[model samples]
Target chain A: MNAAEIYKLSRLAIFWLSVTFGAVWVACWGVGVFIPSLITGKMPFLLQVDNPSTTVVFIADLLRSLTPILSLLVFIPINAMFMVLFERRSLALFTVRMGPNRHGFDGLAQTAADAVKLLFKEDITPRGADAFMFTLAPIIFFAPSIFGALPLLAAVTNNHDLFKVANLPTGIFYILAAASIPVVALVMAGWASNNKYSLVGGLRSAAQAISYEIPLVLSLVTMCLLAGTLDVVEIVEQQKGGILNWNILGGGALSGYDKLAPYWLNLVDTSFDTSAMFGQFYPVPWLSSIMAFVLVICTVLLFGLYLTGACAEINRIPFDLPEAESELVSGYNTEYSGIKFAIFFLAEFTNLFVVSSIATVMFLGGGDNPIPKWILDRLPLEPISNALGSLLSPLIKDLMFIDPATFWAAFWVIVKVYSIVFFAILVRGTLPRFRIDQLMDFGWKRLIPLALILFVVVVFARTWVVCHG
Target chain B: MEFVNVQELVSTGVAEALAFYFIAALAITLSIGVISDKNVIRAGFLLIGVFGGISGLFFLLQAQFIALAQVMIYAVGITLVVVIALMLTNPRLQNEEAEEEAIASSEPALLKFLDSIRNGFPGLVAWIAFVTVYMAIRSEHWEQSTQTIGEDNIAVIGRALTTDYSLPFEFASVLLLAALIGAIMLAKAEKVEDTDTPREGIESGSN
Candidate 1:
């Protein structure tokens, strides 16, 4: 909320996110890349073989295929734990209070301790509760976030071969469908809780998710329309040139600005016709230019719309009506006591992470460097960057263990994703929760019509302009 | 156009067989539950599982767009609405205790058996439908297409909807719009703000 709070959030995010990803990278490299390479005799020159036996080859193939699930299983818990602690610490900083500092170094292990306590606590089914459904709710709630986010790993990793299996032709649609499944779980949780407050919470969740989902989906649909693809990896690839090429910057409606600025500086260069270049940017002369300008404003509004709808979809602050703690008594999970409660809690944070990843991939340009190549070329940092690449090349060449491209992709993805996460935490610290009726009115009356108009405008204007770098 | 088989994603006939049998069995059980369950809300939840299983079957057929649409529209959207409608209209979610009491003082076992036999009417209807479908399958000549399914078949479907099937598509849109307006009118008609009559009890306090 304050500048100091934001600074603290950035510091906490950078430290904790690095620790989380650093551990994930090492573990994933060992299991997914290094060990498989060793088994197949593809790395560590001493282990190299012209032809591996069929059994060894089969084992390597299996290991490689299993990597995605294994890595996600490992990553989700740790990342959730980090996010919980980060949100707490950031919230505490905002509120000017100390948070969970006694557990470990600066309270880093607080969530770890909390998770363990939750696991060992008694998981209870209320006496009147439908036992089968009560047990199944959390599993349903938790499963989609994992499978739904699998395709995202491909987008975040620059479509690494091992992870690309998760990438479907209808990628974003698959994630969206998967994203919707958790609502059923939430309703099931509420009903099976055998409490009035819980049932109301569940019903509220169903209505809220259903209402907000349209705008949430439409906002992304607009981006997908602009980008002309549903595949997250393809969307990311299209946004690769720079920040201006990102969907947030009108999905390359203004890339002409970035492209033509250099032409402006070189106006004296009569070797190439400036008028033809100008014509190239403005296919319909003044109309194209005006539409391109309008497109930029619309895309920026779409980004805001996406963030708002995503917050509602994931039940973040200003929209967390389902589990509105003061009224609902922990909402649908009210009767859930121990490990089941932990699973619900974990999935909630994971959903937030997945939403941020979607925004990053669709709008902010997943894993793409924000700095334009034209700027980078003139920055006098080429040697240092080349040196850095060489430093990473050994891991790819000598060990055949890590693709440098994947490494950098993962790096930018972490930075972008965690930045969004911190922004969400900021929203949580700042905004008051909306009354349920207000939430409905905002979603139905305001967001939906705006989204539809944006979609139509983007569709019409997109034809007159070049989109995405 | 050819087999970009989803079964091959599992890579062997074993996974294919396993997935098919598992989903089919689940669909059967859940559909039965939807009919037989005493609680309407629980039955609605069971309907979701049934839709999920159907979506899984669609996924196996390599119609992923349809499969995902199945999940989004039917499994999540329709089922959620059904559940909400049940919640709003019939507040009693579970009638298990009353049903248990009714069963405790039920008719004789012979009468129960006779009723069970009578309940086989649905089975008889199902058989007739199945036979019709089986005969249709037997009469039709099936051919495998030579063109392989392109990776981006959604674009193909989109083109067909806009061009070849545009009339039907437009008609469908008109029908949907009609339904939307009708629903609004139905809802809005009840909002008669008459201040003529003052209610005298707690019922008036609710409004």
Candidate 2:
């Protein structure tokens, strides 16, 4: 076959190979999940209990737990592939032209196709490179991308639980701590490549990560304090009373009608006992609500900054200074090629997901169903249920197979994650790349101080509520 | 209050020993690399690795907070600043060849002195000093101290910073402010005259 034909053939082969690789990873995860009893001869981590039927329950729990992560591990690359396609379309739209219209399913698989092209492309290791460190950097950078997903796993319930890979007491802190390692790897990559632009990009990344990380940690700490626990599940539980109960606004009494009026007013007016009357009659304490309002606003502001910072950290568009093709000639990956380059690309996409997922969990009431409990209880059940009794009952039973609360909880989480991903894509489409100095100034001068102030305000509010209440 | 488990003690001992060995190895290797590496930038990178290894050792010791601080400040913070400085400033102009030549010229003398230290009078003095210190510390059977009141560390730390450490903190802040102001001044550009030079001597002096 000619060179062009051979190239096309290899492209197809690589595409199938990636799909198969993703499938195998998923299959391995599934088999490990479903046959845990057969493999381990003991209960899986999820199902371990004090009951006699623990092993049976454990296997079931194992499969249940495996589904989300298995899906996540498989779906991340696919999503990343979509993200690249979306970027292309977005760029096309920006330049006012139709882009990739001829590709698989109207440019849907364009990213996957690009991945195949990248995989088969000539892999070059630059001369005078530090081969070992360069090789190791991508692996180090990629490992944390998987581990970073750990804290995103929601707990089974609002109670103290062990639902993550490592049920670290300082769950959020552990995540922040582990997340910093990728910055090191990036710097290493830049340094090892022996390229000036790569070195500059790496330095910028390190500075950006350092500057934004302070706020990210402090803001999450504020959430943790509001939740009264560092556990992700507990944090979600703390937000259970819907959006009002979410710690972004404040928790408990400070959250709802109580914030509308002082204690004296509540005692004076019996009608103000219910939230509806309070909503109508008692005006929200403009000043106190300001505190909660500011907290939410700052949280969002910091989250936006974080999203931008993460783009920079991962060397993606707008913040893709580290790999700016026009200026830096691929930045930190200037000398990387083949599997090593693939790993860096994989890490970048995974990090995009990681940051978005984190933003979702932190600012967006993490896995909380917005449905108020009273509505669920007030649903008309008898006649509608009786008319289609058998079928509806079984269907309802099947629907409620997973606890309704848990189902809704996971639903909110998925929604939040997707929303954040959508935002990331929007950011990629809209913003232009920032200069290195501008990036640093934005991070340190603007973001870090704002995070510090927000953290202090949150602490003061918590203390004030506790002392007075 | 209670006897420690032998197994736990043994495991902890091994872990500590391993950690120490790794730290020592990393320190030695990096020091060697700093002295020997022809590329100055590569030496700086090696120095970063040394910092990271030390930070990892801190983590293994269960000092998670300290480990994070070390990574945040030293490994990433100071190292990056130093690397940036290395990149901005011409390394070749700043003792690059001189450093290599210095090492080469000093090699024989350094090796001879190291041999002497390894085998002679200083080694005897070091052994004696070590034994004396070990015996002195080991022989001291001080009474077990107990606190009458539980210390709230967070409050104590905050109070200490505001009180005893206040002066130092304030001084550090002032120093940082001054540095920032100086940087600003240095970065500010001045207009030039028609002669392709500054209107005043100020610009030339600043440059």
Tens-digit lDDT track of model 1 for A1-469: 4676556556666777777787777777777778877766654355555776666656666777777888888888989899999989888987788766678766768899999999999989998999999999999999999999999989999999888877898999999999999999999999998988899989999899999999989999899888888899999998887788889988888877777765677633546666687777768888888999889999999999999998988888989988999999888899998999999999999999999999999988899899976676578797996897788788778876667788888889888888898899889999999998899999999999999999999999988887763
What are the TM-scores, per candidate, against the unseen true structure?
0.90, 0.69
Model 2 iRMSD vs. native: 9.3
Error of 1 at B61 (Å): 1.7
The RMSD of every model to the true structure, in order and in angstroms, is 4.7, 9.1
Can you write out model 2's per-residue Cα lDDT over B24-112, one digit (the tens) per residue? 79877886797688777767777877877887787665555566667667876778678667767775665866786577566788786
lDDT over C-alpha atoms for residue A21 of model 2? 42
**Can you tell me which runs of candidate 1 are displaced by over 4 Å?**
A1-11, A42-50, A267-270, B1-9, B12-14, B91-127, B188-207
Stretch of 10 with least lDDT, candidate 2 chain A: A156-165
Give stretches of model 2 more than 4 Å off. A1-33, A39-79, A86-108, A154-162, A210-231, A250-254, A258-290, A293-296, A375-407, A448-469, B1-38, B93-207
User: Candidate 1: DockQ?
Assistant: 0.38
